[model samples]
Structure formats: structure tokens, C-alpha cells
Target: MDILSTVELNDCPLCLGPGLLEEEGGHCVYATCLDCGCHTVPVNYRTEAEKLDAAQRVAHLWNVGKVISEGVGE
Candidate 1:
């Protein structure tokens, strides 16, 4: 999770709130909005070395408004 802190991200596109990088099961990374529950598609990684690139990919998706919001708010 420490490595994920290096990735920069934009504000949440759906709620304009703060966003952070999230790791799933120690194998994938994605960006998510803490306030609105919006998240980008997870990028899978096979090895520990690929985690950085995976984090960057998801960050890019999130920064460009490519996130998915399935909850009530838009």
C-alpha cells in the first residue's frame, strides 16, 4: 500500500471529492472516491513489480473521468 501513495490522482469526477488509490487483495490497484463510492476499473498485476504500473494505469483512468459509479449519486 505504501507504493500506491506515489500515484497522483485528480478529484472525483462524480462527486468532486477527494480520491485515493486502492489495492485489492494485494494483486490489483484502482482509484476510488471516498465520499461518493466511485471507482475506476481495477488493473490487475501478476507480480509485485507490476504494482506500480498497475497503479499508474488505474490513476490515468480515474484522472480522465473513466470511473464507474454504481451508487445513487451521479
Candidate 2:
């Protein structure tokens, strides 16, 4: 698995679906659920060095069920 895959996230709190890690333009990261459209707020970062930290924070938010129920993909 890749480094991001190793970040770890729980099943979707809303629908028990698989969680996805999304990085936007290398500026922010967030976690999203594929099934029920649940997602965590994006964590912004200033530099490439901060990407990992932001991703990890989003993953933690996702694991703890801190998410918004709107689908970004849909």
C-alpha cells in the first residue's frame, strides 16, 4: 500500500462504507465516504511539508465520526 493508505481510517459513521482520502491541489486533505456521502472538512496546509500533517488530521476526524453528510463526488 502507499503511504496515504497507511494513514488509517474507520468505516463511514453514516453508512459503514469504505473511506477515501482526498488531496486537493496539494493544498488540503479530507476524508470521504463512498457510500453515504459523508466527509470530513478539509484541512488546509501551507507547504508540501504540511500535506502529511493535514492528511493525518483529516483521517483522525474521519475515524472519530466528525464529518459532514454532503457528497463532494455527487
Candidate 3:
């Protein structure tokens, strides 16, 4: 089974809008919001917990109004 199929994603924490999940080399990477252009950091495929942690961190930063740098997860 694909790793992505097992993961669950939430709306953009910044704008509470829809977003797209990015992938590279067949691995789940980051998520980007369609409305605000905010995105999460590229998550490593080491473990499921790590992936979720990265996503949560991104959401937390957005929630606190921190500016996420661009060109990430490219």
C-alpha cells in the first residue's frame, strides 16, 4: 500500500481553506494551501509519526502568524 493512502490531511491552518499535498520520489512531502500559499516543511519518510509531527509543526507556525519561507519542498 502507498504511504500517502494511509495519511490524513487537514485544511490549511492559516486560511482554513483547501490545500494540495506534494510528493517527490514516490514519498509524501509537504502540503500547500491553495488560498494563502502557505506550505509545510518537507517531511522525511522515516516514520509515520515524524510525518505527522512535521505537518503539525507547519500548522502551528501558520496559526501563530509566522511567515513560511518559499521555495521549500521543491
| For every candidate, C-alpha RMSD to the true structure in Å | 1.9, 3.8, 5.6
TM-score of each: 0.89, 0.83, 0.50
Q: Which window of 10 residues has the lowest lDDT sum in candidate 2?
A: 65-74
Clashing pairs in 1: none
Position 70, candidate 3: lDDT: 57
Worst 10-residue lDDT window, candidate 3: 65-74
In model 2, the runs with Cα more than 4 Å from the true position are 71-74
lDDT of each: 0.90, 0.84, 0.60
User: On a 0 to 1 TM-score scale, where does candidate 3 land against the true structure?
Assistant: 0.50
Model 1 alpha-carbon miss at residue 50, Å: 0.7
User: Pairing residues by index, what is the TM-score of model 2?
Assistant: 0.83
Candidate 3: where is the Cα deviation over 4 Å?
25-28, 46-74
Q: What is candidate 1's lDDT per residue for 1-74, written digit by digit as tens?
A: 58888889999998899999988888888899999888999999988779999998999999899999988654
Per-residue CA lDDT of model 2 for 1-74, tens digit only, reads 45467688889987899999988786788999889877899999987557778888999999888999865533
Instruction: Choose the strongest candidate by lDDT.
Output: 1
lDDT of 1: 0.90
